[model samples]
Target: MAVFRSRFARVLAVIGLAAAMLVGVFVGTASACSCLPGGEGAKYARATHVFTGVVVGRALLSGDPDTAHDDKYRYLVLNYRNHKGSAPALVGVETAVGGATCGIELALWSSYVVFAQGDASDGVVETTLCSGTRLASGGPPVTEEPPTTTTPRPTALGGSSPACPPIA
Candidate 1:
């Protein structure tokens, strides 16, 4: 009877372990951001703004110090194609802090080929990881030259020589 009980305990332990692993897999999938099947051409076709630019500044809108879904990032436009209208010298793009919600965190001073969807006239553009935005290193060759000199932009930040547009 003791031997039978010990074997039963081991079997139960193995079953519990398997169940925990299965639950973990499901939980991981639940937290992951899923995207529809599409390539660059499809992403570009759906984008309202496509540009190569450097992230000059960023601001936390709300939520914890980590970030909210709509943190604003300012970019100095280098080469771009604005489907809505003429492209501006600088633009604001909003996304979450990271990829949990399919949002992308653009590093300050880093260049990216941003495939975004928003009206440039409003002074703010928005994008996500699903938008197909990627590092400039792997993007198309820049045909036009970037700005030779930088201009000071306004921001809500204090004591800054260069800044982004004030938070609205």
Candidate 2:
């Protein structure tokens, strides 16, 4: 009986440690991506822009080109206005059908549409290749709003740009 009890305690200890480690990893990952430089997730949470760009490519499966992965996966490349306003920067977003995948691996993008949520640091943003239905028929119009006192502030850590610069 004593040996059985000891073994049970050991098993419980291992399980507890494993659970704690899993939680730590999750929290760390969330923090890293929360305000990732050039990541749209953080921008989306801030609600800076209502509509951004248009989707240009068809949704493709992760690995198999022959299969249509629209139901399983969705991705878009967005042409967004940059700070200079000289041209639009293209941002890419690849998201799971559901909000299951969240991490640095997924949040990193070349170009993407950034939507302001509320708080830039803590809010969550949805990054995509294009703005999807958010944009007008001809894409987001060029209209400049006067700099407002309530404008979403720029990211302190230089996150205003995309994770990867547009290739073109």
Candidate 3:
């Protein structure tokens, strides 16, 4: 009877260990890089900088594969296909390499459709594979989006001083 109890205790310990390992495996995969899963249009809407450019430079700042952005790659682009916000013709992108940190290995001198997030306060351009930034297979687009658009003010029925636009 004592031997039976001892055997049962060992079995329970083994089961618990197995369960813990299974949970760890599931959690690791789940917590790993998960991009904004959506189509091109959805990614475009979220991106602050969307343009095609040639990568002119790449410098590895850190050897760590787990780093968010350890490499600084510069791009030279003239055309802005879709620029939601203002950016220089030449932009510096900080990114990582390998899928471990959700970074894509961007080749030097290769053209890419750079979808980035520009920090206005600090003035930095950040790009990642998760941002849908990919290589431009052919080249930059032939035409660009229209430079500007003006929002016309709604006129009041009888107004000397212009009132703010109505909420409705």
Structural similarity to truth (TM-score) of each candidate? 0.56, 0.26, 0.53
Better of 1 and 3 by lDDT: 1
Best by TM-score: 1
Worst ten-residue run, lDDT, model 3?
140-149
Off by over 4 Å in 3: 1-31, 63-82, 120-123, 138-168
Top candidate (lDDT): 1
* 1 versus 2: better lDDT goes to: 1
What lDDT tens digits, residue by residue, belong to model 3 across residues 26-82?
775332467866666667777787777777766655556774344444433443354
Report the C-alpha lDDT of model 2 over 1-168, residue by residue, as the tens digit. Answer: 999999999999999999999998877523111234432333333344444445555453464556333233333445455321222234333443433333112222333333422222322233333322233334333334334254343455755543433445
- All models: lDDT? 0.69, 0.40, 0.66
| Model 1 stretches with alpha carbons more than 4 Å out | 1-31, 63-85, 141-168
- Candidate 3 is scored at a TM of 0.53
**Candidate scoring better on TM-score of 1 and 3:** 1
Model 2 CA lDDT for position 22 = 91
Per-residue lDDT of candidate 1, residues 1-168 (tens digit)? 999999999999999999999998877533457876667767776777777777777776665555335444444444454433344767877776568777787778788888888777877778887888888889663333344445666444644555445557
State the local distance difference test value for candidate 3.
0.66
